[model samples]
Target: MWAQAKSGPLPHPITAAGTAPVHDPVPGELYFWPTTDVLAVYYADLGQAVPDPGLIRLGAIDTGLDDLAHAGRRVTVRIDIEGVQ
Candidate 1:
């Protein structure tokens, strides 16, 4: 998922620099790119390689990845933290 703002670059909440950046991302993995300020979710590998500074790993999706893969291009999504309100 490459989320881009219509007006300009998206604003990110990253205060510190990337600790562990990766060039290759796997399925169900979540990453944040500081360069574009975009959040990404990898549901499948399309043989894509991330550039330079790479991607900062946020976390992974534990379930419903199949549903995500089949959700098509544009779909409404809601994210909820397990314990945070």
Candidate 2:
């Protein structure tokens, strides 16, 4: 889970693939990476991008306005998704 990722710094930076409307990601759009089983969220109205190749858009987290700059800092990921099926 995300708690594990937060145990330490990430190996690489999770940058926005490109700039998308912060509004595009509400508070429940989650992206899950099956390869590593890692989860991320657009917690803020910053931007959007594929942190990795196997990244899959799963759901979202309503943590509210948290930064997504991962490297030396740990990030808490909470996600929720709806209408997938």
Best of the candidates, lDDT: 1
Q: Candidate 1: count the clashes.
A: 0
Tens-digit lDDT string for candidate 1 (1-85):
3421111223446633638778888777777776777666777777778788887776677887777677766655444557656
TM-score, candidate number 2: 0.34
- The digit string of per-residue lDDT tens for model 2 on 1-85 reads 2221222233444544543423233334554444454445434334444343534444445445334434335545333345555
Q: What's the lDDT of the predicted structure labeled candidate 2?
A: 0.41
TM for candidate 1 is 0.71
- Candidate lDDT scores, in order, read 0.64, 0.41
Model 2: CA > 4 A from native? 1-28, 44-52, 67-72, 75-85
Worst 10 residues of 2 by lDDT: 1-10
Which predicted model would earn the best TM-score? 1
